[model samples]
Target: MIRGEWQNPALTRCDSKLAFRSLNQAAIQAERASSRTGELIIAYTCFDCGAFHIGHADLSQQLAHTVSVEPGCRECNLPIPEAKKRRARACSAKAIYCSDRCQKVAERKRRAQRQMASVTPQ
Candidate 1:
């Protein structure tokens, strides 16, 4: 049996829904439900109850709402490509620099500025 808590105890048993404490648990339950019912189930956070819930997965609608905007490199302002963005996302990075050379150049400039500021006469 799936483990979850009722959203409200006072309300009618049918009126309240079961809420999962964590996204991971909800996702596991959703997967089981999908296989048992032959439907695409999804796990999502409930805005009103602040808990996870299982619902129907709508891939087409989700794909339509996704934005394609990619940010430029922080140091040289060069545009980042889709491939690089995907790689950065997989590695859990922000992808600030377009390349390692640009990152090194930016670090060197920052180091020089710090040294110059420290050496300035009072």
Candidate 2:
């Protein structure tokens, strides 16, 4: 890409990895614009505008202000591993268990408990 190519406003340019100076500048700009105190973790350099854009590292696609959960496996009550946790968060439908074995065990327990209750007088 030539130097003049960078000048085009409508160019579909790729994101350039921001340098420390660029990130610092973006941080300062963000801080000045907002009264809230927060550090910028993600930075991207715009090739067309030659400007640095600052943002948070929320690759999970969750809402900006929402609290992210480190959810436990429902069936075993064990903490979900990092990769699985991310997958659960990313999934459109909620995840119920860490594995099929735990899910089957829980289902069997529920069925047995229901049978026992039904067999009793009360």
* Candidate whose TM-score is highest: 1
State the lDDT of candidate 2 residue by residue for 1-122, as single tens digits.
55643455334342443333576787676555444645334455655566677655465532564577766788778865666656768976566777768878989999999999889684
Question: Tens digit of lDDT per residue, candidate 1, span 8-109?
Answer: 643443246668989999999988998899877888887666778888778884576468866788888898766777788999987788888888999999
Q: What clash pairs does model 1 have?
A: none
Candidate 2 TM-score over all chains jointly:
0.36
TM-score of each: 0.38, 0.36
Q: Show the colliding residue pairs in model 2.
A: none
Q: After superposition, how far is residue 6 of candidate 2 from its true place, in Å?
A: 47
How much is 33 displaced in model 1, in angstroms? 49
Worst 10 residues of 1 by lDDT: 6-15
Q: Pick the candidate with the highest lDDT.
A: 1
- Clashes found in each candidate (C-alpha, N, C closer than 3 A): 0, 0
